[model samples]
Target: MPYSNESHFHPATFILLGIPDLENIYSWLSVPFFIMYVMAVLGNGAMLLIIQTEQRLHTPMYYFLAMLAFTDLVLSSCIMPKLLSIFWFSSTVIYFEACLFQMFMIHTFTSVESGVLLAMAFDRYVAICNPLRYALVLTNPIILWMGIANVIRGVIIVIPCPGMASRLPYCVTNVIHHSYCDHMAVVKLACVDTTVNSVYGLTVVLLVIVFDVIFISVSYAMILRTVYNLPSKAARSKAINTCTAHICIILLFYTLGLFSFLTHRVGHSVAPYVHILLANYYLLVPPVMNPIVYGIKTKEIREKAFKVFYKKV
Candidate 1:
């Protein structure tokens, strides 16, 4: 059987930003955004190189860390270039297909990041709670499967996105208020019924955010129990310290995410700009902060990165 034509419908314009009206705002925001983007790229790129070159970082934990860094690079790349263009060049018009592609990739990477975080949590849980079996449990085969599982989860969850986007009928307006083709922003422009799109989006959030958080929490709780049971004070401190960075990252990502979702949904037109700002932070913070957090917290990674750069110089 042939595939359906459900994916071919195109919208008129990809963006909704009123360029002339926001020239000053764009100019002001562009300076800081450009700096942030450059830092994110450099920081994440450096971490990726360090992970690849440093033999000490060849463990399962660092494998996931490298994956996370790669995801952050993609995530920031997906949004920042276009945003910088809008600010510097006054080019806010995105093609329909480009917008769809951007939305797909953004969601795909974000979902994969969530899955990767879950895998990391599981790794920490096993390492702390089942120390004797940590090596056996997180064997090469298991790490490979975990990577495959994340990719599968990302693709599967976003399967409905293209269909939902294609079905929407764009009538009058096509200007998206935000920097990128976010799910809610695009769906709001559809003249046709948007029930399907909203339902699918909510379903995805429930799975990725709700379900994933519950599992991560359970894993951490078990980890805490195991930490307390450790007979040696130094052992307990070391175990808790290892989890500190991951815990901080989880708290930041989820808190910002929940705030963005709630503010976007409840604030309406009164605070659209606020919502945009918050959403931008959600995308940018992880990429810029993850490398710094890991570098400062993980002594081996920090030392390896310094040594690699020192040798190069």
Candidate 2:
């Protein structure tokens, strides 16, 4: 539907409803979410600091991991502060421009995270499948280029989404069902036909996330095949063990991510509370869990983390 008139074409501000169907308990919910946010920031921040300071971690694998940690930190920060404010102080009204900026930051960081994961998969692929040439294959210059490419790819692809959504005539309602400005949630509020917005959002998800998942899977598949061909049982065990953290991260990130994506379209049957909760968790979980996963599973990170604590104590 087009706007009833040009006078009704724009909304000056939007209000974010923290979670649908749970307004009474929003404060209680904030406790756990606040904890998760703290953990995400501290954990990822520590990992970034360690990787930067520790000369021993000056390799491609840790380099990629640092990139992932940085993305997680920014990603969690982008959503959680605003969300917490909504729940605690009831600060829900956001300017239209600020909402668009938040939408862009959330989506861009998410896409960047996917790209970083793909880069990590490639790092592991070379390390496992082409160990002898790993150093030569992933030179400092190459790793720097990979990081730059991931940032550029996400930024270039996501710049248009907020513009597309923002240009829509949100003449109907300004209350978003989500805690933060979600692209679909915001666009669907527009009185105008949002087919283009929906299609463009889906296309970007497919191109950035689905495409990255496919290539990461291929890289891991090749790594698996190479590992299987190794004659030594110990070598096979070591190879798979090295991948355990990344594999867990991939599963955690994409599984929740895909579920959240599907629920946006096909989740009418589900309770709004459940859908909103899942969506928040989808963003919060990876950032909080990734650093813990690396700390527990990766020997180098774990060792450095322990040593840092030991020295402090």
Candidate 3:
């Protein structure tokens, strides 16, 4: 049996090869992956709950955090069920529209999450460097608009991706090499020249890394300078501590993202399983750790989380 170069002008379904060359061990792998999904859901869900119920967590910082948690929830939820089916039941076929939808949601939410991280950096910068105007600068209406703006940005940036991919002729093979319907993985299966899709995909990755990381880096740099010049040691330590969770999360998120992106293009020598595993972790680990980092590193979140669970504040 051989696949000819038959062009599917409108493919009905595309087959997914979950974690290429690891089909035999998908059941073994699914356990930990499933646990991660559960942890992400519970952790982010709890963050949202605590942020909403607690009166003290109503400020601009917590508002942005709530949005982050919500984004993580959507990100994980969108991919896990279909992915788990592939892992557990060998249900690797996804309808063409569903695959495109998954690609759109994953990329859009990831972009939105990056925007949220950038927004958090801005919040921290204002809180530390411009404390006097924090209240005025970050009003509830302003925070609301920030959330709206991030969503709009994500939608605008990612809408063209699926449209461009859909128009391409996927005539060669329908077997997507990764677990989920990743954008590049889908587009690579196209028979025609995918230069535009390739360039656009690369551009999207570069845009996210360049803009979000640079602004975040700048914000934290100024924050450090302000903290360094604080009048007292105690004040300096407190300011630094306030930003620890955010800094850790930024490092974790971006490092994973950079590696995943590089592997697709430059890391041709990398094993397919290795690349696929990293891609899966890039999406799952951040969601799983965001709540943990915020819970452990942010004192207020830690205390409230414990109080909610044990009734011992």
Compute the lDDT of residue 311 as modeled in candidate 1.
Answer: 89
Q: Go through the candidates in order and give the clash count of each.
A: 2, 0, 0
TM-score of 2: 0.96
Candidate 2 per-residue lDDT, tens place, 1-313, comes to 2333364475778889889889899889999999999999999999999999999999999999999999998989888999999888999998888999999999999999999999999999999999999999999999999889888998898989898876677766888888888899898898888898889888999999879999999999999999999999999999999999999999999999988887878878888878888888889999999999999998889999999999999
Every model's TM-score: 0.93, 0.96, 0.96
Ranking by lDDT: 3, 2, 1
Model 2: ten consecutive residues of lowest lDDT: 1-10
Assess candidate 1 and give its lDDT: 0.84
lDDT of 2: 0.90
> What is the C-alpha lDDT profile of model 1 across 159-199, one tens digit per residue?
67865786777665767777888887888887778888988
| Each prediction's whole-model lDDT (CA) | 0.84, 0.90, 0.91
Query: Which structure is stronger by TM-score: 2 or 3?
Result: 2
Model with the higher lDDT, candidate 2 or 3: 3
TM-score of 1: 0.93
Q: Candidate 2: which pairs clash? A: none
